[model samples]
Target: MHRMPTLSLPMYDINHQATLGLTSALTTLLQQRGVPAEVSWPQDLLPHWRDDQLLLSQTCGYPLVELLPDVQLVGTFLSSAQGCDGQRYRSWLVVRSADENLTLSDFRGRRAVCNSNDSHSGFNSLRYVIAPLAQDGKFFSATRFSGSHRQSLAALRAGEADIAAIDCITWALLRRNFPQELAGLEIIGETPLCAALPLITSAKTGAATLEKLRSALSELTSEKRYQDLLAESLISGFNVSDRAFYDEVREWKDRAAALGVTAL
Candidate 1:
């Protein structure tokens, strides 16, 4: 007898509280339908990728596209509260107390820190905002790539850097989790709205299977028990979204190429 396929889903630590609940809910939902898919957090999912398993990775716009270039996205998901009003994702460029008096233009000649080049909120989204202001050889006098948003924020907080771009979603989460760390800084400006993170599957997955996955996601949070699980994880909801939403990121890539920040 042929075995039903298993699905693995990995998400970052910012949503660690929600990952297990999400994984279990997905696993149960798929199993009830005889699909036999398993969902899990990133660390759990990463080690099991070699066995022809289906993966459901949750990531922000930049890393999702960069980290799993081989995978085909099934759909994009965003919390109700995290959705923005336009193409530009709503994010902020936060700076330490010492730089509170500086303007956006003043970012030049200062050291700027970011989480990773693969981070949309950390890098790509902000790149679109900063590229326009760059001309000649002038932009940020120096740039540093921290590994995570928390690290980037800490760098600024400790005076190791002058400014960093932080997504509003993570910003709100951090505020709720660590108020004291944020008290020493202020948001200087908002970047363009960006596409939220998405749910992706490997290219080997079938179109019919992808449709079923989308349906499963649409219904995942509707049950009361699942809703409670989401609440504990700080997830509001995952709305149906598509790739066109990410075209703005491609636009940023163009801008990145134009401005010589081409490594993205």
Candidate 2:
């Protein structure tokens, strides 16, 4: 006998309203197939990602390639967010809108912030954008992790950091949920478009259950009934994928490293 674990939509859970809307639809879809599902928010996703009971969740590309090799890749979402196209997404290098006249090079020796080193959109994409401009393995005067993308935006707003790289999907969500946070920020540049977040489930899931999970995602995007819900979540479509589809993300990291730079 097999039991399905809770469904966790943790990555872009920035807005509770949106998260709830999505959770409701997904739960209904899964339940229709006799997959008992409920939303659970794990404070630390690393351990939860590896748990044998993990049913389905979205994770960034960095972790998919570097960690959690055993986690099954479910699929990738085709986000309708501003910086997304097809199955690819990019980052916006943000600074105060007051710096409109300043270019990327103008911020030399200034501070930068990101969500985490493990985050693909926040740190990896950001590092790839500036690795070419680095000197002696250094780019910013100081670099720090602000914990989350919204915090990084707030840091720029509060004058704590000169610039930060934020995922464009997050940028759109903040615009809808908390527009004031971005009131005075502008995108100085856009990073290279790489793979979007990979949806994953536990490797311990039976093949029959795995297909159900994948089918739920596939129908979520293709069906007209969920179109409105998808629009609300900034998801335009969904693409079937495996771990090999995320090789581009790791390539970005390798390209950055080849520049003789480490961190940003």
Per-model C-alpha lDDT, please?
0.68, 0.88
When summed lDDT is taken over every stretch of 10 residues in candidate 2, the lowest stretch is 1-10
Which residue pairs come into collision in candidate 1?
7-38, 10-42, 88-192, 88-193, 88-194, 89-192, 89-193, 89-194
**TM-scores of all candidate predictions against the true structure:** 0.83, 0.96
- The regions of model 1 sitting more than 4 angstroms off are 1-12, 39-52, 63-69, 82-88, 259-264
Error of 2 at 194 (Å): 0.4
Superposed Cα RMSD, model 1 = 3.5
Per-residue alpha-carbon lDDT of candidate 1 for residues 122-185, written as tens digits (9 for 90 to 100): 7776667777677763578777898788888888988888988887767866776667768799
Model 2 error, position 72 (Å):
0.5
Error at 177, model 1, angstroms: 2.4
